[model samples]
Target: MNTILKQFLLVSSIYLFTPTVDAYSLNDSLTKGTAALSSATQVKGEAQQLVGQLQSQLGVSQAQAVGGTGAMLQLAKNQLGANTMSTLSGNATGLSSLLGGSSGLSKNLLSNISSMSGVQSAFSALGMDPAMIQQFLPIVLGFFGEQGVGSTLLGQLQSLWTPAK
Candidate 1:
């Protein structure tokens, strides 16, 4: 039993103390991490710029800008199916943060937004005027479009949100 215990401790210590063989070198890992962080910072900066534009152009508060963006994105996600939404979320770095801190109404709409009334309710819950939604949708979505969110996705959103005029 003592010999068995000794063998176990020896194996355990060897496993614990050995250096891991990583696929990439330390310098390579640092370079990749730095690049990823830079990309994320750039995406976040662009998102902030859009939010600032929304606030300035629409005369809305910061909360309104964030909430409105969330509401609009949630509505689009509801319409476009999860796969497309996931792609958008993955590619658009700050998008997840914007969607995450939204009001309950916006988060609830993530699951279902089949009716116009439902859409209006979500926006209204964010304290947005119904009239403002018409103006707000285009700006938020257009920013995403400029950020390379894909023309196809933007087209679908435009079709859904735009009235039959």
Candidate 2:
């Protein structure tokens, strides 16, 4: 009994103190930039594809138009192109262009807008000075954090709310 207990403790301690498996650092330029971009791109492409599929299936972008996730996903895919991340990471010029203007909207927001013209019309009706809001949408999107939604639906809700006397 004493010998068996000793052997069990020895084996238990060895198992408990065994060296952990060495894990490779997942840090690298391609991973941080290109790989991230590729993933974002693939995600966006898949979203766009899904949106396309859903649109074809449903014959309406209304449900998504109301919330706009699929559209936004495709847009992010476009702005953060799989290849562009490699350049944008180090180049101020790429960074500046990303921060620049309306052209940037071609990605997420624009596609969202395009998904349903009625949505665009509704926003236009709310008296959005398109010329202004168009340029800074991304900054605003950034302010909202990862989901990049809530505010848009909030805006829609606000539009629906009746004015107080």
Candidate 3:
């Protein structure tokens, strides 16, 4: 009888302690997963915010681009003959055509907006509101043009929206 009692006692203690060990590991895994998810969510939110900043900037920039291109085209028209003006107008139309892919110009602009990490971070560091930086869009658009970024962004958006045909 004494031997039986000691064997039963040992079995019960082992089973109880084994569960505590497993419970700890389970809790640790859950904690790590939760932390990772939280970090991912934050990055996504920041990325969306950065996208918004870019969109606002793009609207202003596109307007400026169209306006400037129009003005230049007009000036050239005034200085040159109808034939020369036609050439300049055709070129501007071609440039703007790239912006007007199937998804429209806004999607292309949105893509450019997402890729603007350096510009966004600079704005952040300076404590400058992205919306408040309207005056600077033309300058930034010029930079984007120089870098061949605008067309690249348009291409990216086009690929995303292009039909599988």
Candidate 4:
């Protein structure tokens, strides 16, 4: 009975004293998540500024700028791989609302816009002038360049800007 009691006490002490193994890993994950979210917020701010630039430059309504910009971003997203798209989308807060809010309009607008001509078509379909498409492409690409998008993705986006014939 004495030996059994001693063994039980030792086992209980060991169990009680064991350190929590998950605490460090969980904290690390949280730190990474917070950093990622912070980056997304910064990118979102830059995107909003670009939208403002579009509105002011084109004399279009806010809705037009946001929607058009969203469509353009969707075009780029379509060209990227799944992981890149996820990172891009996750980092932009304005994307969700500008993409037409879960309705089919956004998807439909993006469906036809696979290239430069498609960009003009999509904008024209949205009631924007075809002439303005060239102007908007540089603005969008310039904004992304400022935001530090890599050459690969930026190049992909730039390819969508064939000037009006």
Candidate 5:
């Protein structure tokens, strides 16, 4: 009876003292989840600021602002190539999110807009006049300028966006 009691005590102590693997893994997962949520929130806030600006300045709806900005960014991506667009996106917060698949428009739709005419059509599809693209351009350029985009890149964007006479 004495030996059995000692063995039971030793087993109980071992179980009590041993650290749980699940606890450490759960903590790590929670930390990662929190960081990811924070990053997503920051991106959403930055995009919201731009969307708010577009809505107030252009008198457009939230969907219009997102779709228009997405259209323009999609055009820039098509014209500038992935590396250049990556640089541009790095300079501007939430720029990538605007062009991301989750932005109001679908990935397939954004990928389809490779030119100014395509942008205009996208604008039209968003219930905005195609000419509104002109208004959106200046505001978007100004926003990029404020975000510290280089003049050379800005010039390239301007040239790409400007309608030919």
Candidate 6:
């Protein structure tokens, strides 16, 4: 009976004294979540700066800016292909986010805008005239130029966005 009592006490003490192990603690989870949110905000801020420029310069709404810019980028991606677009995105911070991380509305609006006509349709959907594509070209090109995109890539984007005579 004494041995049984000793074993019981030992087991109880072991359980009571043992530290709990968690893969992710509440504090750790919160820290990681905060870090992720901060990173996302930075990316969004970069995108917002570009969008704001488009809106203010063109007198368009936020949706128009995002959709128009996204349409142009999608068209570029389609024309330049993924590898070249990757190079462009590498040179320009937040370009990838504009391409893939904008709001769901812009994504849905611009996802199919891989061709010139699609771009026009996207502009029409946003209540902007198709002629606005020309207006958006220089601003986007200038934005890329300011972002340190090389002249070669800028030339390619310009040619892609420009209509042939």
Backbone clash numbers for all candidates listed: 0, 2, 0, 0, 0, 0
lDDT tens readout by residue for model 1, 97-123: 455433343344333555445556555
| Most TM-score-accurate candidate | 5
Candidate models: Cα lDDT each = 0.62, 0.34, 0.36, 0.61, 0.74, 0.70
**Model 3 Cα displacement at 30 (Å)?**
61
- Report clash pairs, candidate 5: none
| Top of the candidates by lDDT | 5
Candidate 5 at 139: error in angstroms? 0.7
Lowest lDDT sum, 10 consecutive residues, model 5, at 34-43
lDDT-best of 4 and 6: 6
Off by over 4 Å in 1: 1-45, 101-112, 163-165
**Poorest lDDT segment (10 consecutive residues) of candidate 3:** 37-46
Q: Is candidate 1 or candidate 4 better by TM-score?
A: 1
Runs with alpha carbons beyond 4 Å of true place in candidate 4: 1-46, 90-92, 163-165
Which digits, one per residue and each the tens of the lDDT, describe model 4 over residues 1-165? 699999999999998887667975765654443233222222244467787888888787565576567656666665554565555555444555454445454455454555666656556645678677667888877776666667777776677555535
Kindly give the stretch of ten consecutive residues in candidate 2 with the minimal lDDT sum.
Answer: 92-101
* Candidate structures ordered by TM-score, highest first: 5, 6, 1, 4, 3, 2
Give the alpha carbon lDDT tens digit for every residue of 1-165 in model 2.
699999999999998886555422322321233222222332222233433443454343423322233223233334445353233223222222222112333233334332334333333432333232232233323322332335554354233221223
TM-score of each: 0.60, 0.18, 0.22, 0.58, 0.69, 0.66
Model 3 Cα lDDT, one tens digit per residue, 1-165? 699999999999988777676787866664443233222221222223322334465443333333222222222333343454344334333332222223332222222222234224323322344333333444433433443444654343233222234
| Model 6 misplaced regions, further than 4 Å | 1-45, 100-109
lDDT at 57, model 1:
92
Q: Higher-TM-score candidate among 1 and 5?
A: 5
Clashing pairs in 1: none
